[model samples]
Target: MRFVQVAQHADDLKRAAAFYAALFDVEPAALFDPPGLLFFDVGGVRLLLEKGAPSSLLYFEVADLHGTVAALRSRGVKIVQDPQLIYTHDDNTLGPSNSEEWMAFIEDSESNTVGLVSHTLAAGD
Candidate 1:
């Protein structure tokens, strides 16, 4: 099976939508005012933000790691960690068999954790 959508809890939908739109450079596909829910399009993925708790953790993969991080920072997004390289192995491969990628995390106004990831495979494997 494939992953379809992820729903995140937000204290305020409008604030959350504006924060995400500024960070991702895309407007929400739709917003339900009474329910306070916002839907965002991330390629084929759909992110649903609904009013609930104050904090949550969400992850999104992007192509431009540095640019995205910078843009998010410029928009007043709180940076939890600067972009850094991380390596992992699919299996317990021996010597120099690990793959690497870049990733970063940020906190929304409500202190929710949002991760930005850039994979090596999509950059041409």
Candidate 2:
């Protein structure tokens, strides 16, 4: 079955909401306080930010890894690891053939490590 929702810890909902909104470039789909829950529709998956949920390391695919990292850095977002080529997809098993997979890590507002990924055409491809 496909993922319906993913939960992430957020001590302060407002702070987390603002951070996520900037990163995702979209407003949250829903918020339910009192019980303290906020949700964002991430590619049809519900990203639930909750007060009691444990922190999760989430990975998101972006069209431009470097550009996204730069924009985030300019906004004082902590870059845990700079973007770098992670792997070359020689075959179509994990990704498109003759493509390069790049990845970078950053710290979310709540201090959870988040991974950003991108795939680009390999040299001479």
Candidate 3:
């Protein structure tokens, strides 16, 4: 099955929209003014933000680790964890191998945990 959309509750739609726009470096494709629902295109995935209960965590895979982190920081988004390297071992040889993946967590005004991830593994790796 293919993934379609993920939704997060926002306390303030405008503020949350701005936060996400800055974090992802793209504006929302649509916004429902009366209902306070905003939609953003994240690569091939769709993210929907509306006024409701806050979410615990939402993970997003991004292309540019440094640029995404910088944008989030500039917008005053709280960083729960900074980007760091993680080591993985080869399954067959048990040899040490390194992969560059970065993770960061942030809470919106409504206390939704937004996680940013950058996976460095190749298609077949």
Candidate 4:
């Protein structure tokens, strides 16, 4: 089954909305004016943010983690962890050994951490 929605908590909705709008460059599909909440359509998934302590970190998959990282870096997004192999499925995986299961992380405006994941093998892998 496909994931339809994911949520992230934000103590300040206005700030959260601004941070996400710039990062995604997309207007939220749904929003609440006060006590705020915002939702951005990430592909088909609705990324929801509510007023509260930050929720668990979300990991978004990317075709090219390195390229994605570079773009985010240019936008001044803080890289929490450089992309590396987070796992390797021996029998079943989309890529060759050594480079499968790659990931990287960055911090958002609300100090919420988000990650980028990929299945492609890196150069040296």
Give lDDT: candidate 3, residue 58: 84
User: What is the Cα-based lDDT of residue 4 in candidate 4?
Assistant: 94
Candidate 1 to truth, TM: 0.76
Per residue, candidate 1 scores C-alpha lDDT tens digits across 1-125 of 87787888778777888888877789999988886778998877788888763345777778888888898788777889999877654543621234456789999755688888875532234
* Model 2 segments more than 4 A misplaced: none
Winning model by lDDT: 2
lDDT: worst 10-residue window of model 1: 89-98
Cα deviation at 61, candidate 1, in Å, is: 1.5
RMSD of 3: 4.8
**Candidate order (TM-score):** 2, 4, 1, 3
Q: What TM-score would candidate 2 get against the native?
A: 0.97
- Model 4 regions lying over 4 Å from their true place: 93-99, 121-125
**lDDT of each residue in 75-103, candidate 2, tens digit only:** 99999999999999999999889999999
Whole-model lDDT, model 1: 0.76
Given candidate 1, what's the lDDT at residue 121?
39
Cα lDDT of candidate 3 equals 0.73
- Each model's TM-score, in the order given? 0.76, 0.97, 0.73, 0.77
List, residue by residue over 31-111, the lDDT tens digit for candidate 3: 988877789998777888887645747877777766777877787777677776543444424222434456777677667
Q: Which has the better lDDT: candidate 1, or candidate 4?
A: 4
